[model samples]
Target: MDVFEALYTTRAMRRVKEDPIPDNIIKSMIDSAIRAPSGSNRQNWKFLVVTDKNIREKLSNIYRETWDYYINSFLNSAKDPGASSLKKQNDKDIETIRRISNSASWLAENYHKVPLLVLALSRNDPTGSSIYPAIWNLMLAARGHGIGTCLTTVMSFETEKVFEVLNIPNDKGWTLNATITAGYPLGKWGVAERKPVDDVTYLNTWGNKTNWNLEQPLWNY
Candidate 1:
């Protein structure tokens, strides 16, 4: 697959088939991930490719609880329903969120059924500036191989439980960055819609307009 194609179409593909991904393919994904740059070239990252049934089941329960807690927190903080323009925009967002939440719930319930669950860990990188690039590289590599992946941090809420379940050393230095679910996609691939680059990019300084009037993506799949 093309690099740009992978970048654009690799959305959070939570819904995936239960077929097992080949070991060679999983190895290749990690091999591609490590090539990504790290902070000061420390290269302090570890990936735990979890395929065991019992461990995955335990992790799934923790993930489900965290996901529910996250969604409930959002619900509790949501604004009151109203007929104003802001409320209308929020309603639209909420609708989309509900759809995504449904998919997330599905994943939580059947996480163990998916083929691969890769947990990324890092040491001393508080901002995760180094680890996330490599994690994204792993996802992009999976996309190149026609595998779907979803990078989720909800499991981090139960850090101690995860460590115990995975037999990870209870060292404060090593932190759980994210858990990525991987399998063949049950959904079709398509370009993800996002705000145009021109709207977000600045010419030289902060708040300085670029004056680029791009209303659509410059490239096509």
Candidate 2:
């Protein structure tokens, strides 16, 4: 797929089939990921691919606990129903929270069934700037390969436990930046609606409107 097509079509895929992803495919995705620019070319990224059934089951349990805590927090916040505006805002937030909680719960229950679990780790003292760009590249690359990936930080909530369980070395400074659960997708993917660029971009000064028109194609035909 073209860059634009991949950018537009890639979405967070939480649900995937149980089929295993080939090691060659996983390698290709990682190859694309490492090409992403990093701070001072430090290239301090490590990936841990977990396929062991026992470890997956243990992580799933932790994920479920974290998801439950998130749901309880959302419910507690929505319990206070006072003014109309307050109610509307809270209701919207509650709805989004509920959807995320449900999706996470599904993953928690079924993570063991996924083909691969990838943990992207960073150095103990990374530049703190280039990390996310590298992650974005990985997700986009996975999308291009017809593989679905979800960038989750749920495992970070139980980092110490994860480290202990996985036997990750402490001195390695192996902090989990993101966890990607990957497999073949069960359905189609599409672009999510975004705010108009005019609302966010400025030409030269803050608050000044950008003159460029995204509606028009970049190259004149």
Give the Cα lDDT of each candidate.
0.88, 0.77
C-alpha TM-scores of all predictions: 0.91, 0.83
Whole-model lDDT, candidate 1? 0.88
Index of the highest-lDDT prediction = 1
Instruction: Compute the lDDT for candidate 2.
Output: 0.77
- What TM-score quantifies how close candidate 1 is to the native fold? 0.91
Error at 178, model 1, angstroms: 0.4
**Candidate achieving the largest TM-score:** 1
| Cα TM-score of candidate 2 | 0.83
What is the C-alpha lDDT profile of model 2 across 1-221, one tens digit per residue?
A: 88887887777787899888888888887888888888887888888888788898887777677767766665765675653554444566677767777776777778878788888888844455666777788888899889888888877878888888888887767788888888899878876445567777997899999856666433221
What residue runs in model 2 are displaced by over 4 Å at the alpha carbon? 78-91, 124-127, 209-221
Q: Model 2: clashing residue pairs?
A: none
Judge candidate 1 at residue 83 and give its lDDT.
45
